[model samples]
Target: MKRALILAALVLGLGGAGWWYASQRDATGAEADPPTVAVTRGTVERTVLASGVIEAGTLVPVGARVSGQIETLAVELGQKVKAGDLVAVIDSLDQQNEVLKARADLAQIEAQQASNAASIREAELALDRTRQLNRTDLASTQALEAAEATLAVRQAEARALAAQRDRAQVALASAELALERTRITAPVGGTVVAIVTDEGETLNASAETPTIVKIADLERMVVKAEISEADVIRVKPGQTATLTLLGDPSTAFEATLRFVEPAPPGIAQNDAAETTEAVFFNGLLDVENPDGLLRIGMTVQVSILLERASDVLTVPSLVVSRGDGGRSTVRVWDPASRTATEREVRTGIDNAVTVEIVEGLAEGELVVAARDSDTASAAVTMRGRRSVFGF
Candidate 1:
């Protein structure tokens, strides 16, 4: 009975081993299927990124023409103003005093001029009387000669006084003009961006350095973007662009390319060295800032649209594999057979994520992005079998 029980135990162990092997085979079969990906063919866009700053197209610098103590400031920084508006007032007391002194000097000069004129008339009358007396023989010849000499001397003195009066009048007019220029006014309709001086601050007009107040027209603006030498060739004037402000990421402003600097300003070229690097050109974009949201010196990101393709065939960038022979290839998946077939293709305008398939690819076709490890192993095994059999 013991021998029979041991033989039955060995039989049960063999059955369990066979059942475990069958289950393993079933699991292996289930794992043999290749990984699949949904292929999509759609239009792809290529964009060039460049960092820049938002700026006003027309920036006018407002400076003080005449120097004096700052008496009153009519506008503050960031205050909106109109053309011909009063911006600030220098100590008009000194200026007004200058005006008053000039006027007084002019009045004094005119009075002197009238006195000279009266002296000239009196001299003429005296000369006439002396001449009449000499003709009547009631006066000596020497006396008549003396009267003529006195008249000539008085006329010369009157002329010199008249000349001095005229000079004084000219000086007065110049002083009046200088006094009028003391009131600082805005040259353009814009906002005051900065104020350089406060009330009671003394300024020097004759100083070599000028006190400056900054102003700008916020209604219109421009972006001066520097396009890299590699991609500058694709940019041109009149091209449309979009500006994204660093301050407000949600706001996107539209602009048009107005100018491209032909030669880089203030850059020296090295011809002796063999270099692929070139100088970048400056591009200007005119933008409208109607709401006055954009300020001067605001940083921005610029995307220059060089070229656009609509409804063109495209593929994923990873699927495109470069061959050692300089040929580009992609794995086209056969849905029914669950196999990937390699095909040579030509590409154009490859962006970071997607590439434009110019030839050898069609819409609604499956392309393999990656292969499962098991599928790769199976492929290797099939290739090994073919090589061993010389098939």
Candidate 2:
């Protein structure tokens, strides 16, 4: 009888412990239910961010026109220069020798031409005298014909000498022009962006590589911003854009879109495969750097405003849940009891943080962002028991 009583007591204790453990688990789940959100209203902005470099609107790469050794560089990188200013001088000795040879050849041809002219005149006079003598029967017919033939030959030789003189003069002018090219000059009024060739460097202008210097007009600058194909269609010429320098974030320069490239430049040769599928369209923004604050290749951030909306009802994106069949739903809170109710909504123009709610929700209304499922079930069961047991 004592063993029977002990076994019964142990079974009852075990049953009580099992019931307590289940009760504790249910209580823990119930405490986790209520969803919370703070309702507020303010303004939000939509923006696209991209990084790009600052570039001069007018950039010119100066190059040596003639192949020669660089004698001296009058300017260095970042030097301000004016149009027609001499930047560097090449060794003009070879060019000078060429010019002298051309001139000497020209002078020799001119002297020969003078002699040829005098001989032609003398031959013509001889021919006339012979004809007169022949008419009077004082000269032989053969002598008269020989004099005429000499006159014709002398005239042809004079014409040939004149042509040679003209050719020699052209050669001299060409040599002089080539000599002038040895002195490199700035073509436009600007700052020297780079000096490619240093003093004593041998430049081979005939070997297909040509540029020696780079000059840019820095008074005005352009922001060549790349816009993705998706956003490019919305952008157009004359649209207002704001440019912000990378290091300087406190200030922004205002500009207008000057142009949009119809096709990307050098797209076929680009080896970056990730960006290959992203067709980038270029947009030009014109800004005046009057203080000379902008420099070539300086990075800049650009913002182009596409559209705007004013005084619209909006909600936090987390509260707007995507439902079945592509429907957008939201959890609306009851103002009287602070209880959440699922409601279908229409949304538009979402900026990722907040969404524009067109219908089914009003301003200043609280919305639930997902409640703990276990807590919600426990709360529902508690309410059901209270109703059923009349407590």
Candidate 3:
């Protein structure tokens, strides 16, 4: 039922638009009963239009590396922060205890090494005495060998104790680093846009770093536009573009195209009853936001200028019918004779609405494009429904 009503509304809207268009074509003016416009030298531009969103060009997602309960959240959402500023603090009691334990272990190893050194000295003295006795035939060869072996063992033990102390020192340093990491600091200077975790929130960041906050440079804004595949070829980097927000269509801002994705994706637009699969290429435009009027995810209309001609003789392209080859004719109105006559003219640039007249037309000449007769007062909507807003 809902779909049927929507379809009916669309049909009615289209019919109304058609009636309104035909009526406007018949409206009478000072000279005739049809709508006519004068041929004049002016500038005409052709543009490709698209819809997009305004986003921060540089956005940082701050995350926690270690898992612990959040002890202090220093910055709130929308808070400005500088690099190295403390943003959050995690529980550090366990890490601190680990550091203390590592220190104790290192100290114990050092004491053991000292004792082993003393033992080595004592054993060396005994080996010297045994060697002297053996030289005098007072000690057996086995006694000398035993004393030498004891000294060697003591020295080996000292070396092993030194290695253990070195490893313990490294462990202590690692533990200290872990303890310092409990105090999280800002990576860059920006405004905090989001705060995912709060004080007392436990974060398990083992599998992946859990986002604590989001920071973004709001001044550097970019527009992510999706251009239809049919019109994407006309758009390229370095093209001038104009953007208008959905809410404020009258206010426009200028931008420059910076990037266009080569690999276009299939975009799926879902409706209540059907789905539309469209191929679109992604484009990026760098927009200046000094006034801060734009925001993240705000919908904007993008118009990319493809071609522009200045001081060119232009006419409504729709009324100019084309013949064989390069021949085109337009119904030029003569104000003096009050008659319409078809005149063949050379054409230049032609767009959906306007065409440039190269010859066979003069300035101040009139051509009937539509009629301003009945004034049916029907609505003049550009389309039955806008594809951008999907309504």
Q: Pick the candidate with the highest lDDT.
A: 3
Q: What is the C-alpha RMSD of each candidate to the true structure, in Å?
A: 9.6, 8.0, 11.4
For 297-371, candidate 2 gives per-residue lDDT tens digits of 888998876654567777777778887896998777775774678888887767788877778877777777663
- TM for every model, in the order presented, reads 0.68, 0.70, 0.74
lDDT of each: 0.75, 0.79, 0.85
Candidate number with the higher TM-score (1 or 2): 2
Badly placed stretches (over 4 Å) of model 2 are 1-48, 264-266, 270-276, 308-391
Candidate 2 lDDT: 0.79
RMSD of 1: 9.6
lDDT of each residue in 1-391, candidate 3, tens digit only: 9978987887787777766666544355232245678898987788999999999978999888888999999998889899899999999998899999999999999888888888999999999999999999999999999999999999889888888988999999999998988899999988899998889999897899998999888887999999987999888899999999999999999999999987654323432322256777889999988877999999999999998888988888777877888678888877677778888898887767888888999988898785322343324335444634265
Q: What are the runs in model 1 whose C-alpha is more than 4 Å off?
A: 1-43, 118-166, 209-212, 246-251, 260-282, 317-348, 357-362, 370-391
TM-score of 3: 0.74
